[model samples]
Target: MSLELANYEAQAREAVKMFWGNREAALAKQVASGNQDAGTRGAVTAGKNMDGFLALAQSLVSANGLAMADIHVQRRVLTLPGFFRPTKLWDMLVIYRGQLVAALEFKSQVGPSFGNNFNNRSEEAIGTAHDLWTAYREGAFGEDSARPFLGWVMLVEDCPASRSAVRDTEPHFPVFPEFKGASYSTRYDLLCKKLVQEGLYTSAAFLSSPRTAAGDGAYTHLSELTSLKTFVTDFSAHIAAVAAR
Candidate 1:
């Protein structure tokens, strides 16, 4: 039987539109209250910018035969045990039949400050995956349990700064060839691809959209490997396989 993808392409475009639209709304709300956060923090702190993607994920689980799965999105119920830390909170968690079906992280980055934020995001992604896998290996979820689908989805603002070549200082040694002259978007593409290649996440997606995307819901996938289509297809397949079992 074919995997059910839940019409994710259209949902993803709508999600992209919501992402930008929500950010703008959040920023405006804060400014109206005379409590605007510095830089893009206002949009982020207001939260729910990625709820559209969350809805898509929920739909995929239901369409693929996990309608009864406990999809946790609330902060109080999102904590999972960690190896290095006592607990880690995920953006979403799927549990079914007393087993963890999946855990996913949804993140976004916007500029005037891509350089530092990129490094921070990279470190956080790597560390989070390592921590989760180590905890899983230690039976954090349950004994003799199948590995759950772990996914990461990142949305970045597409603009001149993020798309331009980033120069790095090579004081001691050269950086990796692939990263030497890559733009932020290219770097995120590499990050997502490598996360899957190293078995850190079952699938990772990289998407970019301009501020203007709020009007028409336009977005771009940096590469086929990290595209939203690939992410949703893999996720839907995993959900179907879990249901089969």
Candidate 2:
């Protein structure tokens, strides 16, 4: 791996460790003390433990030497106007030279409830991209010469619940053949691939790390297209070319 990418890999482990830390802290704080809404469990169940994704984003932007002023990770600052919806909050946003440079979303799913959350995650991902593209086509960001870079990074827990076959029931008609007997991991892989294939995203990374070993950034990647290495490489190349000009 390139030096910059090597650094990202090392730092990815930090994200994993931070994820666990945040989870444990939230639970501990609520249990030890008397706090009801302290932990991250929610109706939507997104952004439960985001430290790892944030770290991943920080490493990427810093590696590219992006100015701190040009980046926004806060919810208020990251919200952008949309065509389908009024506005949507993004995980990370970068604007430079009066143009939207990039927008990224990070999502993760833990085990024991993969079946319930799979479709929700997919719909959210697709709808978010569709809304952004339509908004961009309608000049939501501005009259930039080119489209902004859109990225997605998903971290999935490596557990039996997520890896086992997910039963699919098609009541009226048949579903996609590839989806047959697919697990949560496989579904995510397909989702990332389709997002890029449809031009909904510039690149997408589907990463998996075990709860036990993710602290050291230990994970497995089987898909070449959606690998974190591929995502980082592609993202770095885009940043490099844009910054050079």
Candidate 3:
């Protein structure tokens, strides 16, 4: 059977708009209240910036097949057992007939401090995937549960700082050729691809949009491998397959 992509491109554009709009609104609200946070913490603490993307994911689950699946978005019910830690909270979870269908993480990074934030995000992504997979292998879900689809989606601010090549100092060993002078955007693309390649995630997506994206919801994908299209297509297919069974 053909997979249903659920018209994700248009929905993703709207999601981008919502992402930027939310951040701006959050920042403005804090400033107006005379309680602005340090740096961008005000906007970050507001949360719900990625609700639009979460809605798109929910639509995909229902439109493609599992209309009745329990799509968990509430914070209280999103925890899953982890191997390295007690539990991990996912951004979204899909459960059907007592079986875990999918788990997804949606993340975004804004400018002025991409370097530190990028490193932190990378470590978190890698650790989260490793912990989950290890738990899965140990029957954290169920003894006979099918492998659930794990996905990661990232949104970054597009600007000269994020796109410009970065220099790295290697004292003893040389860095990989591909990463020798990779920009923050390129590094994200590489991270997404490697996550999938190493089976850390079933699929990963990397997106970039300028602050102006709040107006038109314009976004860019670095590569087909890590594009939102590929991410949703693969996810839709997985959901469809599980529904068929």
- Model 3, 45-139: lDDT tens per residue? 99999999999989889877799999999999999999999999999999999989999999999887888899999999999999999999999
- Residue 98 CA error for candidate 1 (Å)? 0.9
lDDT by residue (tens digit), candidate 2, 1-245:
34666777776777777666666566666656665452346312324586566666656765775644387787779899899889999999878777787889988877668876888988999999999999999888877646788999988889888789877888999889989998889999999999999988999989887878634657777599998888888877776666766
lDDT scores in order: 0.93, 0.78, 0.93
Cα-based lDDT at residue 108, candidate 1: 96
Least lDDT summed over 10 consecutive residues: which range in candidate 1? 1-10
List residue ranges in candidate 1 displaced over 4 A: 1-6
lDDT of candidate 3? 0.93
lDDT of 1: 0.93
